[model samples]
Every structure is written in structure tokens, then in C-alpha cells.
Target: MRYVLGIDGGGSKTVCILMNDARQVIGRSEAGSSNYQSIGIAATLKSIQSAICSAVTSTVKIEAICLGLAGVGRAADIENVKVLVQELQNSQLLPIIWDLQPSNIVICNDALIALVGGVGHDVGIVAAVGTGSIIFGRNHQGKTKRVGGWGYILGDEGSAYKIAIAGLQAALKSYDGREISTSLVENFKQHLSLASIEDLIEVIYRQGWKVKEIAALAPIVDLAAASGDEVANKIIDNAAEELIKATSTVINAIFSQNSGLEVITTGSVWRGSSKIHERFTASIINEFPHAKVIFPRFEPAYGAGLLALQRLTR
Candidate 1:
């Protein structure tokens, strides 16, 4: 039986799945982050190799492998990933042999895999919002468009980090009587175990909180919004509107207004209790009536496996 390997590597983790010709997943494993741009090439290679080694139980020659990684958009970044994959193929730690041709190796950004896996097809839009946000869409004509994804420094509108920052800002403003009252002040204080709102300065700056750490506090805002906190709800509304705007841009760029397509929502931000997903879906549907908004149908690793399998046919 022909076999293929699919890998979904991102900033947080790497996932590997072994699938056969019949599209049956035989083995699966995970490792640490493999975003070479963030964790460096050597570490990324090691993580990929480790996940591959753990996923392949039997001694089998793999036909193809697809790696969908984060921060791999630019041509230079793609080439760098190609070199990293080449290094992985030459590694001695893997148990199985890869009988890969140049066409058998598929490398792409994580967004594409999310699109493929979310809808069980390659043609759709994926609005991913985590600590960062990006909107990517591909039509049947093979044309694609992307919005946002500039990271936290420049962009990342409608993302969890942005939401958390907004919440914090509102809390401080309310404390100083510069803005309307918000439950966010108490929520943040309780969630972080801070003695006062002023202590947040030390917690954020002095304690060295990273993007992920800050993003984790987004649930506080979400919960407050769910409980009918006006400011928190406004923050959620703004986030939904931003995502809607980004999604609308992608729909208009590559998809006709009447084109029936899926717009998949991926990542932690959509999982919030504030009903942001519903808000986004309603707004998108209201704007582009033919668009179907959805969550992922399968994990990205499965989509990578499908892409790897497609290489054999091509």
C-alpha cells in the first residue's frame, strides 16, 4: 500500500500523521514548534524529525510528504523551509525511508492547510485568529488573497492579543475616570491575582509577559462580554467587525459575490464564550450571502496528508 506523511508545523507545536493510500490515518504524533523563522532551523528540523520518527511505526517507504508551516509566506521563507525539509530527509534518526521526487515534497503556509482541512477541500477562505490573525482565501481558479498577518507589532487586528490589550487599556482608563466603567478592571485583577489595577504595570512589563501570555487573558474579556459587560461586549463587537471586514476583503478579491464557498474560522479566538464566531458568521453572511462560515472539519495535519497524497496524482 502506498503511504504518505503530512505535517502541520506552527509556532506552538508540530503534528505528524501517517496515512495510507486509502486515506486511513495509521499513526500520529506531535512535537514542539517547527516554525524555523521563530525557533531556528536546527530546532525546527529536530522537531520535524522527532514527530516523523514517532508517527512511523513500521518500516515503510513513504511516497510523499507535505509540510504546512507558519511564517512561510515569502519566496525566501519557502526556500528556507525547502532546505530544512531537505535536511530532515537526510537525517539518520527517522525510521522510514522517503522515496520522494521533487514534486512529492509539498511545502506551504499553515493557513492553506487550515483552509483545506477546515472544509475538506483546497478552495475556500480561512480566517485564523489566535494570538495573531490572518485571512486567506483561494478560489477554484487557483487565485488567492491574504489579509492581515503582519504580527502583533504592526497588525493582528481582531486577534486575542489585541483584544486583551484593549481590555487592559479600558480597565486603566476607567480606573483614571477617563472612560466608561468596565468589569474588565476587576476581571483582570482577579484573573492575574493582582492586588490592584496599578500592579498590572509590573505584571505586564516587569514580569516579562509574552504575546501568548497576554493573549491568554482574552478569555476574561470574552467572559465579561458573555456576562453583559458593555465595554467588553464592545471590544468583542469591534473584533468581530474587524474580522468581518478582513473576510469580506478576501471574498471580494478572489471570490465572486454569488460564489458559494466556505469561510472557515480557525484558532483560539473563535472558541471564546463571547459568541464572536456567531457574530462573524452573521456579518459575513449578511455581506456575502452565498458564503458558508464554518469551523474546521479536520485538523490541519490531515489536510497536509491529503496534499501529500495529491502529489502522487500530479
Candidate 2:
């Protein structure tokens, strides 16, 4: 029996799935970050290898491998990952002597797979907000457009990282009496287990908390919003507006505003109940009355698997 491998490599983690011709999931494994740009080629390859090894146990030939990864948008980035895959195939640690060649392996930016997985199709817009945010859309003619996804430094304006950072800043503002007092300060102290506001400095800087850690704080802000904190609700509202704006930008670029578009919303930010999702949905519908907003039909890795299956047909 022939099989295929699908990989979704994100800034936070990597997921690998092994599937057969019938689309049955036979093996699944996860590993650390595979963002080559952030983690380096060697580390990224090592993580991917570890995940793949755990997922493959039998001698079945892997017909194709599709990877949807962050920082792989440009042609050069795709070429670099192609070379890395070649190294993985040559590495003695690979579980089997597979039929995978560069031609059989497909690599694309993570957003594309997210779109495919979210909508269960190749034509639609995907608004993904994880630790970062990006909106990607493809038209019927294969024309594609993207907006946002500038990373935490430049943009990622509607992302969990942005929301959490804003909450932290609001907490500091409340502490310094620069803004109206809110539950955020107390929530921050309790969540981080800080003795005092002064300790936040060490936690943020000296402790070296990174993007994922900061993004984790987003739920806390959500909790505050749920409790009816005006400050928290306002933050979520602003975030929702930003995402709506970005989504609109892509829709306008690739599809007419009046078009009947299917919009798939994915990522951690959309996983739970938040005012952000609600406001984004409302705003998008107001702008594009014919647009339909929905959640992902499948995970991004599974979308990659579907792409791998297509490779076999080709």
C-alpha cells in the first residue's frame, strides 16, 4: 500500500501525519518549531525528522510529502526547504527508503494549507490568527493575494501576541495611573504569579519570554473581557476591527466585495469564545454581505496530506 505524509510547520510547533490511499490516518506525531527562518535549517530539519520518524513504522512507500510551513513564501525559501528535504531523505535516520523525490514533494506557505484545510477547498480566503495573523485568498483563476502577516515586529496586528501585548501595556498603564483602573493589573499579577508590578520587568525581560509565551496571555485578556471589563472588551473590539480590515484587503485584491466568498477563520485565536471573533464576523458580513464566515473543516496538516495525494495523481 502506498502512503503520503503531510506536515504543518508553525512557529510554535510541527505536526506530521501519515495517511494511506483511502485517506485514513495511520500515524501522527508532533515536534518542536520548524520555522527555518526562526529556528535555523538544521534545527528545523531535525524537528521535522523526529516527527516523521515517529509517524512511520511500516515499510510502505511514501508516495509524496507536502509541507505547509511558515517563512516559506518566496521562491528562494521554497528552494531552501527543497534542499533540506533532500538532506532528510539522505539522512540515515529516515525510517524507510521511500519514493519521495523533490518533484513529489510540495512546499507552500502555511497560509495556503490553512485555507485549504479551513474551507476544504483551494478557493477562498483564510484569516488565520495564531501567535501571528495573516489573511490569504485565492481566486477561481488561481490569482492569490495576501495581507498582514508582517510578524510581531512590523504587524501581526490582529494576532494573539498583539492582543496580549496590548493587555500587558494596559495593565502597566493602569498601574501607573495613566488610564482608568481595570482588572487586568490584578489578572496579570495572578496569572504570572508576581509579587508586585515591579516584578513584571524581570519576567518580561530578564526571564526572556518569547512570542509563544506572550501569546499565551491572550486568554487571560479574554477572561477579563468575559467578566465585563470595559478595557478588555475594547481591546478585543479593536483587534477584531484590525482583522476585519486585513481580511477585507485580501478580498478586495482577489475577489469583488460583492462576490459570494467563503471565508475560513483558523488558528488559536478563533478556537474559543471571544468578542474578537464575533466582531470580525459581524464586520465582514457588513462589508461583504454575500460572504460566509466559517471555521476550518480540517487541520492544516490534513490539507497538506490532501495536496500530497494530488501529487500522486499528477
Candidate 3:
């Protein structure tokens, strides 16, 4: 009769999954961003708490709650979130009663759950690319390693943000006679309704365009590539190579065996038909002939539930 709650809190949304001890899913709910770094502690807690309450009935007793969240990589972040969860538990706003001690509430970075969700196990690599990019993996021996999650400023080499930035730069360069002429220049102008290159500065900086806004331009680059723009194709091709390199590094560091490696691609950028996803898949397969690239079997929230179950058993 025991149940566990798993929450995956990302930059934009929070998802909670309720699962029974028999591994059957009971309820699933979603809320807004629960990233404490961006939304602050109170709002983050509110989002997570709301998702949990909506997921299960009031009579259900949760044996454990596992939260895999963005912006929780540091130990201090974990401690802070733990304190917030405790406060929420004592607030009595949640529908179900928490049966276990404070230790039963497991908290970790979201990448770990994405790894588990993608491969359906504790061992494998997850190369998740979105507004930001990170590669996390765990080996069969329980050893783990991570690479290339340095965020937008210093890293995020193969992310949507990166792709969009590169496209913008190329468009500007082409306009300034510094790079090869491509359709991206016209695409940018048409997409953003800019009359000239001069307006781009005002639109991006003066208009307060940020990471997400700039990232929205990535599809323009994709369009240009689809139309046989060599410059755009090169940009996507290079991005794919960077992601492959990061994935290969994690695989080499964690799994030394020459056999097939289970590598999962998660996030919006990897989904559906995109030049980046296609190139990344081909490049990774070329590098590791036995590599099996797959999508996540369950969303990361369910993976967080799996982690909660593991916490109770451990």
C-alpha cells in the first residue's frame, strides 16, 4: 500500500508523479518552474507543493518524495531545497501524509533522473540539450561522471541558445560583409521584422532579449539549413560534433567496455526531425558503432519517482 512521489523541476515546468510500491503509476500533475535559482525558494516550493497536492488523493500516504531539480547541483542548493521541503511538509498544505523521516526525501540534480528515465536504469549516459546542455552518466560499477553543464555564459556549446547565438552572429557577419552570404540574414530580418542590421542591436539589447528569447531564433537557422545554406549547415554540423564529443567523453570516462553503450538523448532539441538531432545521431553512431541511441522511456518526473522508490528500499 506504500506510495512514493517523484518530482522533476525544470527551468520552465515542474512535474510530479505518484507511484505505488508495485511500480504502478497512480497520478501525475504539473506546475510552473520550481528552479530555486531563477524563481526563488518560496516560489519553487510553491510550485513543487502544488504539483504534489494535485497528483494524489488526500488519504494517500507517501513513503518517500524524490525531487530531481534544475539548479540543484551544489551541496548548498540541496541543503536549501531540503529545508524548503521540510517547511512545506510541516505546513500541512499537501494532500497526503508523509510517512517517513526527513531523510526519506531525496533531492538531486535533474540530469540524474533524466539519465535514469532515458535508459530505464541507473547505468548509462544522458545527453540532454535544451536552452542549456549537460551530459550525465553512471557506469555499472556505480561510478558517475558529468561534463559540459557550464550554463549559457561559459559553456552550453551545443544547446539551442548556442545554436541561436551562432546563427545571429553569422547573420550579422554576412550583413557586414565578413562572412558568406546566406538566407539567414533575410530570415532574421523577416522573422523579427527588422528593417536593417542596425535594428538588431536595439531589438536584442535595448528590447531586453535574454537566453530564451535568443534561443527562439534557432529554428530560423534550421530553416536556412533545410534550404541548402552551407553556412547554416556548417553551424548545425559543428554543434552536433560538440554534443557528440561531450557524450563520448562521458562514455569513455565511465564505461570502458567496448560493447554497445546505452546513450539516451533527452530534451526538445533531440526530439522529432532536426538537422542537429540527425547529425548528432549519425556522428555518435559513427564514433561508437555499437552505440544504441534512444529516447527516454518515461519523462524525468517518473524517473524521479523511481529514484524515490530506490531511496525507500535503500
Candidate 4:
């Protein structure tokens, strides 16, 4: 039976899935970050190679392979990944042999795979909010549009990082009496084990907290909101509104207002206890009533596998 490999590589981790012609997943494995922009090309290649090596268990020929990676939107980034794939094919270190055609090697941004995996198809919207955020959409006509995804400093409006940052800012504001009283101050102090809220300055800057590390604190805001903290709830509301706006933009661009489509929410931000998902879903449905909001039907690696399988037919 013909087999294919699908790889979902991101800033945090890389996952590989081996599947047969019937779309049955046979092997799966994971490795470290493969986003070349964040971890460099060498490390990205190493992670992709490691995941692929660990996933393939038998001598079945891989007909095609799709690598859906983060930070791979630009043409230069795509070419770089192509070179990495070529290097993998040439290397004898893998347990299996390689004779993949160039056309069968699919490379795309992680957002595309997320959309595909979220709804089990390519034509939908994906509002992905993790350490960062990006909105991507594709329609039946093959047209596409994207919003946000500029990273933390520029955009990522409705992301975990943004939520965490807003929570921290609200805490500081409460501390200085600049804003209404909020439990965020105590929550941050307790969550981070800080003696005082001012200690957050050292933890955020002096202690070298990364974006992901800071994003991990978003649950504090979510929990506070769930417990009836007005400031925290406002933060959650703002995040949901921003995502709604971005999703609306995508829907208008490539889809009809009444088009029946799926708007899949992916990543950590949607997992918050603050009912952000319900808020987002309600807003999207109010604006585009036919749009269906959903969680992922399958992991991104599975979508990558589907894309790889599609290459054979194309």
C-alpha cells in the first residue's frame, strides 16, 4: 500500500504522522520547534528530520509528504524549507528510502494545515490564538485571505500572549490606582509567587521570560474572569471582539455574507475558562449567521497527511 507523511511543524513543536492509502495513521512522533524564523534553519531541519525518522516504522515507500510549518509564508521561507526537504531525501540517515517527486512534496504555512485539520477540509476560517494569533481563510473558489499574525509586537490581537499582557497591565494599573480595583493584581502576585506586584517587572524583563512563558499566565486572567473579575472579563471581551473583527474581515473578503462555512478556533486562547469561545462563537454567528464555529476535528498533522495524499491525485 502507498503511504504518505504529514508534518505539522511549529514554534513549540513538530509532529509527524505516517498514513497509508486508506488514510489510516500507522505511525506518529514528535520533535522540537521547526520554525526556521524562531529557531534557525539548522535547528528546524534537525527537528523535522528527527520527527520524520521517529515516525516511519516500516519500509513502505512514501508517495508524498506535506510539511506545514510556522513562519513559512514568504517565498524565501518556502524555498528554504524545500531545501531542507531535499536534504532529508538525500540523507541516508532515515530508516526508509526516498524517491519523492518535487510536485508531491507539499509545503505550506501552519495556518493552512490548521484550517484543513480543524474542519477536515481546506475551505474555512481558522482563528488560531496560541503564544501568538493569526486568522486565515479559504473559500470554495480557492481564493484566500489572512489577518493578524504579525507577531506579538505588531499584532496577535486575540492571543494568549496579548491576554496575559493585558492582565499584567491591568494589575499594574490597579496597583497604581489608575484603574478600578481588580483581582488581577492578587492573581498575578499569587500565580507568579511574587512578593509584590512590582516584582513582575523583574520576572518579565530581568528574568528573561519568553513569549510562551508569559503566555502561560493567561489562565490567571481567564480564571479571574470566570470568578467575576470585571477587569479580567474586560480583557477577555476585548480579545474576543478583536478575533471576531478579524474573522469578519476574512469572511467578507473570500466568502459571501450568507455563505455556510466553518470558523474553527484553534490554540490555547480558546481553552480559557472565561467563556471566550462562547463569546467568539456568538459574535461570529450574530454577524455571519450561517458560519459554524468549531474546534479541530483532527490534529494538524492529520491535515498535513491529507494534503500529502491530495498531491497524488493532483
In model 2, the runs with Cα more than 4 Å from the true position are 95-97, 100-102
Model 3: residues with Cα > 4 Å off, grouped in runs: 272-274
TM-score of each: 0.98, 0.92, 0.96, 0.98
Report the error of model 4 at residue 74, Å: 1.0
What is the C-alpha lDDT profile of model 4 across 1-314, one tens digit per residue?
78899999988899999988788999999999998897899998899889988998667688899999988888998899889988888878787767699899999999999999888878999999998999999999889899999999999998999999999999999999999999999888888899999999999999999988998999999999999999999999999999999999999999998779998899988988889999999888998989999999999999999999988877
Per-residue lDDT of candidate 1, residues 191-299 (tens digit): 8899999999999999999999999989999999999999999999999999999999999999988889998899899999999999998888898889899889999
Clashes of 4: 0
Which has the higher lDDT value, candidate number 1 or candidate number 2?
Answer: 1
Q: What local lDDT score does residue 222 receive in model 3, on the 0 to 100 scale?
A: 76
| Candidate 2 backbone collisions, by pair | none
Q: Candidate 2, residues 186-229: lDDT per residue as tens digits?
A: 99999899999778899999999999899999998888987899
Clash count per candidate? 0, 0, 0, 0
Order of candidate numbers by lDDT, starting with the best: 1, 4, 2, 3
Please provide, for model 3 over 97-157, each residue's C-alpha lDDT reduced to its tens digit, 9 standing for 90 to 100: 7687777888899999998877776788899988899999988788989998999999998
Tell me how candidate 4 scores on lDDT: 0.92
Question: Per-residue error at 30 for model 3, in Å?
Answer: 0.7
